[model samples]
Target: MGDVWAAGDAYEDYVGRWSRRVAVPFLRWLDVPAGKRWVDVGCGTGALTSAVLAWKDPAQVIGVDTSEGFLARARAQVSDTRASFRTGDARSLPLPDRRFDAVVSGLALNFVPEPHLAVAEFGRVAAKGGTVAAYVWDYGEGMAMMRYFWDAATALDPAAAELDEDRRFPLCRPEPLHQLWADTGLDEIAVEPIEVATVFADFDDYWRPFLGGQGPAPGYATSLDKEHRHALRDLLSTRLPTAPDGSIALTARAWAVRGVAGRPA
Candidate 1:
């Protein structure tokens, strides 16, 4: 089954919350100067765009995404005069070349059909000496919340492995991330891990969002019959570590890559 991207609110509940957290350290890592132009490619819900506006005090932040639902939510939430949302593809951006001082994407690179083309576009739009960066979940290991869920899920139904993001996206890893930037002729390449704490008051706080059907795991979840779904849920409940306060605390890690842009490969 294909992933869902049109339900902005549902996505917000799923990964947008964590993406916002990732955006903070991500911008700090870029260390771009104030009043620079920025492009948030695959800028879903304006999380990174809002971060640019709030943190970098940019001259402008142009956010591009394919989903109108996400752009609408972004437009509504990020009313800052410096930020604007547009519908566009990552592989073929409508932006002019070498116009942005900082080009960044958050939790979005892996979702691109051809992420290398998207990276090339990122390099194309970024000004000489400008920074190009993006982040994606470490779904195979470090993303604890999803890690636990997937572990519990695959155990219950081996077929679920086909939809598992860990197996699906190899580029989310650090080595591949660095190679992609290097192949694009981006210099000063670096890949760092950004982790955020995801604490759920109870299993329900974590479980209900899976029912929203906004992403791969959630989409896979809602596809199951009632019995199979409940079986998966029960399996997760038994497996996840629960604190005495009844909270389920987990960490989500995303691999972030950055480089200086100018040359093309």
Candidate 2:
């Protein structure tokens, strides 16, 4: 339940695309100035790192993650000279204190075990008055695609409801996110929702990602036996809102929060 990340390609195939969509607006919301030093904690596959390099024009952008597979992918995919990827724990980042002007994560905070520790690490490394921000899927209600998948999965197997992200990660909601930042002693704390269009070309586009076994829903899907997996998939097919043109358009919402890192107590 703590860390499901493996097979970076599979993870990219599943949610990396949507995470990139969220990253653009999330960066815009942060509005950090160009040439600032930035670090992306738990930077799974470098979604936010790439966004920072492209949009923010950071002086330097270091991406840290526990998953070597993801770090390798980040290095290969994000080819900017200003960016670098390293393997590091989110709860104990491998960096000097107060080195970065911006510390940001996207679609990753909820996946870190003891996420508060990771946020504390973010505060520990961010310069005073620097931006400390992150965004995560509102798995409870705002993330429609996963909501559809889990709702269908649980309808067929009521016991599977316990595996749902809405039940498992209480931190993905706005109140909890805001509180976590407050508890970290960050100033000017605020939270907002970021929604993006997740239009799947067809049912195959949506269903195949679940077979990737990267994130939670896909991990649960791949755990089932062949027949049971097929049953669960068929159930999802019927329940999803598919357009007559063989497309499925849904929205994903992530709660984004930001605060200015303050001096240590």
lDDT of the candidates, in the order given:
0.91, 0.91
- In model 2, where do residues sit more than 4 Å from their true spots? 1-3, 263-265
Model 2 lDDT tens row, 19-96:
999999999999899999999998989889999998998999999998898998888899999998888998999999
- Compare the candidates by lDDT and give the number of the best one: 2
Error of 1 at 175 (Å): 0.5
Candidate 2 Cα deviation (angstroms), residue 105: 0.8
TM-score of each: 0.98, 0.97
Per-residue error (Å), model 2, residue 265: 13
**TM-score, model 1 to reference:** 0.98
- Give lDDT: candidate 1, residue 194: 92
- Residue 246 lDDT in model 2? 90
